[model samples]
Target chain A: QQPVQSPQAVILREGEDAVINCSSSKALYSVHWYRQKHGEAPVFLMILLKGGEQKGHDKISASFNEKKQQSSLYLTASQLSYSGTYFCGSRKTGANSKLTFGKGITLSVRP
Target chain B: EAGVVQSPRYKIIEKKQPVAFWCNPISGHNTLYWYLQNLGQGPELLIRYENEEAVDDSQLPKDRFSAERLKGVDSTLKIQPAELGDSAVYLCASSATGELFFGEGSRLTVL
Candidate 1:
């Protein structure tokens, strides 16, 4: 099953902050985040494993809550380059585990 | 190192025609995935290959869609008698662990 993402779209001014949330009905072993610019491939952002680790890079951060079966991506001091579609892929534990992705959220950062 | 490579970047064909897309994964990667993404939507997994074995392909339209990862290095996805609804971007990704490296994608337009 595909994960569900909140806030289908968001618009932000440069330096603003935004959060995209992903939730799954099943227990997740890991949550992976990626961002895709127009006409470009999706680039890996970060991965949060089951231990509830919060990872960040520069102004981008993410948190995964195993108990809640959810993950959130945080973008602080958003830049123009941040404008793109964000997708969250979740992998469930157990045999035959496969990664499933959410429908995605579009983030637009303006100057 | 070169990321996942896919070609051609764009293709157009009439309905009922056959179309094929190719992908070469990152060196030493053991997993390859094919996904379909509609405009304004996130990628949906069509198939996943662990080495040369297809571990998951339940989401693929078996009647008209087929895929193969030959020698566990390169992959090809083909659609026979393509329909208008098949017009979408085909993305190929490879992974050594779980974080994926994606190609630019092959955009298919069925007219």
Candidate 2:
């Protein structure tokens, strides 16, 4: 099942902060985040395992609540290049489980 | 290392036709995935493969959609008798250690 994301769209000025949320009805094994620019491939941001172990790049931070089946992405001091559509995908069961993604949140950072 | 590669960046066809998209995941990545992304939406899982075997294809519409991963390196997704509703972008992604790397994606426009 697909997750649910809030704030379908958000616009922020440079140096501002924004938060995007994702929650799934089914239990989650892991939550993954990605960002995609217009006409470009989706780039990996981070992944949080059920036990809270996280692996990802810098410039962005995220938290996963295994008990609640929810996750949040934090963009602090947003930069112009941070503008993009953010997607949250979650796996419900095992390593072989497919990732189901939410509708996505559109973020725009203006100078 | 090269990222996932997909062919036919764009395709336009009339309804009731057939289309196929190809993908080559990064070398050494044992897991591959095909996703369908609609305009202004996140990518949804169509199928998943592990090595040369299909591990998950529950979301795929078997009536008109079929996929295969040969040698666990290259994969193809085909759609027959396409409908206007099938107009969307097909994304190919690969993962190892739980992180996904996506390709440029193939955009299909069924007129």
Best by DockQ: 2
Identify the runs in model 2 with alpha carbons over 4 angstroms from their true place.
A53-57
Compared with the true structure, what per-residue lDDT tens digits does model 2 show for residues B1-111?
888889999999999999999999999999999999999989988998989888888899999999998777999999998999999999999988888999999999999
TM-score of chain A of each: 0.95, 0.93
DockQ, candidate 2, comes to 0.85
Consecutive 10-residue window with the lowest summed lDDT within model 1 chain B: B93-102
What TM-score would candidate 1 get against the native?
Answer: 0.97
> Per-residue lDDT tens digits of candidate 1, residues A1-111?
799999999999999999999999998989999999999999999989998999999999999998999999999999999999999999997323687889899999999
TM-score of each: 0.97, 0.95
Report clash pairs, candidate 2.
none
How well is each residue in B1-111 modelled by candidate 1, as lDDT tens digits?
A: 999999999999999999999999999999899999999888999999999999999999999999998888999999998999999999999998779899999999999
Q: How many backbone clashes does candidate 2 have?
A: 0
Superposed Cα deviation of residue B53, candidate 2 (Å) = 1.0
Which residue runs does candidate 1 get wrong by more than 4 Å? Answer: A94-96
Each prediction's Cα lDDT score? 0.93, 0.91
